[model samples]
Target: MPSMFGRTTKKLVKEIGDQELRPVKCLVSATKIRRFSLIQRKKARSRFWQLPDVPLDVSLMHILEPGSSVPDAAVEVSADFSDTEVMKQQAAGSVNAGAEAGFSEETAVCRGSSLEYQIVSTPHETWTELQKRKLPDPEPYFLKQCREAGVNLYVVTETVELRNSPVLQDHSSMNISGKFSIPLNIFVKGEGQGGGLKVREKKLTVPKGSVVAYKRKQLVFKEKDWGIHHIAEDDDQETFPAGRVQKALGLGADFKLLQEEVSQKVKAAELSKDMQNIVFSNLLAMLGDREALQDLMDKLEQEPFGHLDGPGGTILTELQKDSCYSGVVSKCLILYLLETLMVLSDIQHVLLAQSMEKRILLPQRDLVRSILEPNFNCSENTPFTLQPELLAPLQGEALAITYGLLDECGLKMELNSPRSTWDPEAKEPLCALYGALSVLSQLAEA
Candidate 1:
């Protein structure tokens, strides 16, 4: 291009400078936005919150030295913090440690890996005295478990001093009561621990029994020490229900108001026997001991049985027929009833089936049929009518109670013309008839 206009180029070069004119050619280009570039990382930040705040500087000095073994370490700050006074205490002895020299928002970074800490405490002659012994690295150990199990560890340090300024009067037992204020340092670590991370601490009152065991992801609140009592053998005749059922039953509706008011009232009365048996059965289930079940079965058998009015017959009858109570039985009728009802109740279908065949020595088909059979049914030999012929032999009040119970159980039946088809609407009086007879039998037996 300069060749086409040599005179213009020469004139321009001469006006500017010879040296500048010698390097005239140039190239230019444009680029789109390139936002990111790769670089090596020097420090890494924690992906989650930092560990709880502990006075490691003050406490570690007494137990661990600076040259401790560690690998792959990092630190980050968290929003959690400790009491200002505790910060001061920790800072006093934190000069030589890696701790920050002054008060800052940066808290301890949790070491991610598990740190093995040994127990170092001042020994005492008595176990109670051990409570007073200052523990080394107690906060760290407690905090480590808290983080691993995902819980909170609260530390409270209380000082107890024996004062000798009391007046010794002629009193057998002296009672000194007064209000005094003492400082308490509460350190609440963040929910978790490991790599030294941000720790949150708070100041609060220490309630008795607040501390609990953290095991298998469970937090058990501390319990008072009541004297231990061994569970009595089922045969000992001392088995007692915990009374939850009895409490539930006693709170049931009032029945006397039902007659005139036709209002809501509990149709069923609380059976002391049923509640006791259920509670006993629950306790046995918790034990999960086959031996315990067998023991209960043996105890149940040995228990006396007579008429319903007798001392132990009702309870014995209930227990004897509960398939849950498994053991040797001199009579097969009780076992058969238990095995059949358990299946029908859907409590343990498979287990009951296997038990009936293998343990109780009954055919599976028969047991299943017995369970499926309706509680009340027409005589198989007769047509559809109030089948009083098929009803279990009951007399007087027993018959009345039987009818009432069946009615409550939803077995509505009707006694129609013997020659005509049975209508359920006509069955109400027939039910009343049987109810009277059943009740009479029960009253006589009672």
Candidate 2:
């Protein structure tokens, strides 16, 4: 039974081998195969993948035909061929792109070639040749014509001579000799006056110890005479009073000392005595000297308001005839002191340091605004009204103080509605507001 099974297996294997070796039938026509091969060849010859050096093989074309029996091998070869063509197209595209970019760059560089070359190379030889060329000297004929026209064609040279004078003489003499050279006209071919070559000599003898005096006439105009008159000069000369040297007090001087000095100046026979006294007194009151300031305030409060002369005949009473005088004086005093403190660097430091310990009461915001307001009546000189005469100078002082303080402190505070509270947090800003208001007030007055 085993021998029979072996023989059957051998016969089945031989049959299977015969079936596997059988040939396949072609479905596509020869025309289609020829057309497909022609298309592929045309594509291969196109500009995208041109290969003129390598010719297509007839045998390979024939194998690539559609109706060929070896479909698997043909399909694989066509795939590889398509891949190679795609790779060639990509390489050609990259090469063209690179060439275009390079061409553009080269074109740009060539555009300004002349200018770029000139800038890079030095023209030292050309410059040297230009420097070597000398300008021709002026022609004699031109000079002759200039002299004939009275144009003065001569160069004047001066020489200084130092000589010792006789000791018995009252004065010394300095001899200054000048030489004038008149060039002869070479173009005219002659010399002398007719040829425009002429020389003139001049000598001046200034006598030593000689005194010349002339009476100086005064240019005066009389009411009777319409024209100006030259009258005899008057011997009297008008003299102006000297200004106060506030700097003598020094920036670091004590507040009391400054007050005393200011008081002394105010009491002295000086111009604007009343104004000076009021201004200084107000300044003293503002320096945070509570005891002194309070005493003054109490005295002012005790005085009769309406009458010019009260029981004590106080300064406040004298000023109180004008209702605005008290407020204005106080305001001006504060402004003045603020300015003085700002001007003195040392004093500013002291004030800033002391500000931390003793905070001074600031004037009411409304009162400050009223004084600083532009439209407020400056023309009125009636009782209780601000004197128009004093307004301008007070305003100027205020503005100056404001500027100085702002510059020194470098503080930017709102001026329109300043914080009037005397709290530590508000002190610096309050001071800054005072300055800003002063500036604004001056502007309004202007």
Candidate 3:
């Protein structure tokens, strides 16, 4: 009896994590010999066991399913002991001949405890069987058992504590009192048993002008929907949380504050008169806020001239530095801002009473208009060799920015003139610029 206990305990300890349980030894009589059998008492319990203290690593048990044609699987058993004493005990089982030997006595000896297992080598056909049987769904049974066994299931670590909390007492009564539970789903990596699921943080690259759909915590883009979502730079690179656009866009919690702030500012004109004029008149120029827009801008402003400019500033500075597309797009945005200020100035002239006009209104309008339309070419300037390649896309973003500003200023743009190809279809300039920067950043990376 002592030898049997030692062998069984040794075998049980060796088969961990793989959700496997193997029978290696059993009790026997002088007249008949019967080997021990490892049976699954719970429908979906694991066939492997975990022993953090053991050096050989996680173990599993393999057994042939009932009605299968294959030979009984090689029951791979193990134990916690460094020596072979336990293995020797498990192998000393009684014989089973043509007689039902007194079963009550043997049952009593093995009644109070059961072996732990991890499913190591599943039958090849088991997946089909599992589809039908659904026997090893880890969520309810196998994971629960591991939790009972004192393994932190979801968090993978190099070292962990392992314990076999008793399900039944030595006297054969249920011992339900002192057990603890795991907090989350146990995560595993690599192979079978409790070793193939993982929670990892991943980064994916997105291309410019692509329409991404959020679903199941992943960003998805269908081939046909690309051009519908207007992006200014169409080449900007952007990063967001994995899946669900709302989450990736930071639309939750404090991020939702953006809408609130925007609403409050637009609703109440608390700013000084000059600030209000500047905000609305040059709204197209401020297609983005300095502080909040920095999030989208940060990605583009990396390396070389990163310290000098953010995304919006970088676009402006780079256009000035490079001779691409004659800096047409950059010029377009600047010109739009200038024209917008001129229009606002004309409006101020109309609104001014003669007495207040010369003292306050006219000088401020002159200063703003001059600043927006700086005379660069009137002086001696180097002629730039422009590249035609970037003209169209840059032109698109510039136009988008203009449209956004007009909307922000609550002003109507006249598109009837030859120079005015301003598309009314373009929405708010700030939003367009946001989209454009996102697109362009993605393009820059590509």
Candidate 4:
């Protein structure tokens, strides 16, 4: 039995040796050994902290120095051992060298083109030194251009009261407020390239209340034109209509036959002989009597013809009373006498003289009113009929008076007469003459 047991054990040992041995079971598992190995690695890693290598030889003073250059140092390190390991070691050595030279891993791998830099310094200079530099003069060029273009610049200093402002249905004349300005330059265009050229520039302030006349953008100075002198003053002086009659009769060169002509015209009219004689005698008396003229002037001075009331207590009184000329004769007769007086050359001379003496400009309507007050005692539309025989002589006489006045004032310029001239400065006298003649013409036609 012992022999058989020994053989059996040997066979079993051989079988066991020939076949794979089975692992023995334990209380601890394979999973537990792996978990313990991982724990040990974590603890070893946490025990020691890794830090970036810094060079001890480099000093802070060397880095802060201006215009200083530092040389880059190279390092080599490798762990791989193979046939291709040399190439890998070479790359690793380059990376380590770049890192030691203060370059990041990304910057070392991805190299870019070299960059260049320039340094600039701050400037130090005073503003006064900069302004002292030479500059071009512009005043000469500006004044030259002004001279070439004949441009004038005037500053208006004052504005005075306006006269003869336009009324409804009246377009012949307009008087704007006086605009005064002192000329800064008087530039006249040269004749024949540069003949008779004068440029005067004076800086002067116009006196207060000095009237200016603006015509077509040109300034009219009173000292240059005598006609405008009347416009520069206020209208306060009274005009004497009888003075016109007295002058006409006293200077009877052409007026000696004026009474005879008027008488002949009145005798041929469709009026009674007595009415003609009455009209004739009253006109003669007005011409001969100086006291009558003085009385009329006193009455005119006391109250303007326009402000007088009629006999019937109303403006439109049928039977005239308390009037200077209305109670003398019929309205037709008064109209005839007015026509006769308005035609006198002496009347024009007297009016012009008075205007100059008083330095006052009278309107044409006022001039007409001085001769004959409107018959407020009649209807507003009442018509006064003069003898048809009298119309021609009256119109001719009015024309003669107008031309005479224009000539006496030295305003007759054939084609460029002051009578035809229109401007704000000359408007005063021009309007007066035009208005008076226009009324007389209308009366003669009526």
Report the lDDT tens digits of candidate 1 across residue range 133-234: 332333335333333333322211211111111111110111111221110111211221122322332222222211111001111112211111112111
TM-score of 1: 0.16
Clashes of each: 41, 2, 68, 0
Per-candidate local distance difference test: 0.23, 0.25, 0.24, 0.24
Q: Hey, what RMSD does candidate 1 come out at?
A: 38.5
TM-score of 3: 0.15
Ranked by TM-score, the better of candidates 2 and 3 is 2
Estimate TM-scores for all models. Answer: 0.16, 0.16, 0.15, 0.19
How well is each residue in 343-403 modelled by candidate 3, as lDDT tens digits?
2212222222221212222232222122212221122222222122322221222322332
| lDDT score of residue 355 within candidate 2 | 29
Q: Order the candidates by TM-score, highest first — what do you get?
A: 4, 2, 1, 3
Taking every candidate in turn, the Cα RMSD to the unseen true structure, in Å, is 38.5, 54.6, 35.0, 57.1
Tell me the deviation in Å of residue 100 in model 2: 67
Candidate 4 local lDDT, 1-446, one digit each (tens)? 01121222223223334222111111121112110011000000010111111112222122121332322121211111111001110111111111122111111111111111111111123212322322223323432332333322111111111121211110111111111121111111111211121222222222221211110111111211111112232111111111221111222222214324434333334333444344333333354233343233223322233232322112112313424443333343344433333323334534433332232223333332322222212223333322233222222223233334544322331211212321222222332343333323222322
Candidate 4: 10-residue stretch with minimal lDDT? 38-47
Which lDDT tens digits does candidate 2 get at residues 1-446? 01121222223224334322111111111112211111111111011111111111221223221332322211110000000001110011111111121110000000000000000111334323322333223323432332232221111011011121111111112221222121111111111221122222222222221111111211111221111112322212111112331222222433234324334322332224454455344433344432333234334433243222322234454455444644444434433334323323333333332322222212222233333333222333222333333323322123223323333332231111122222222223333334423322222221
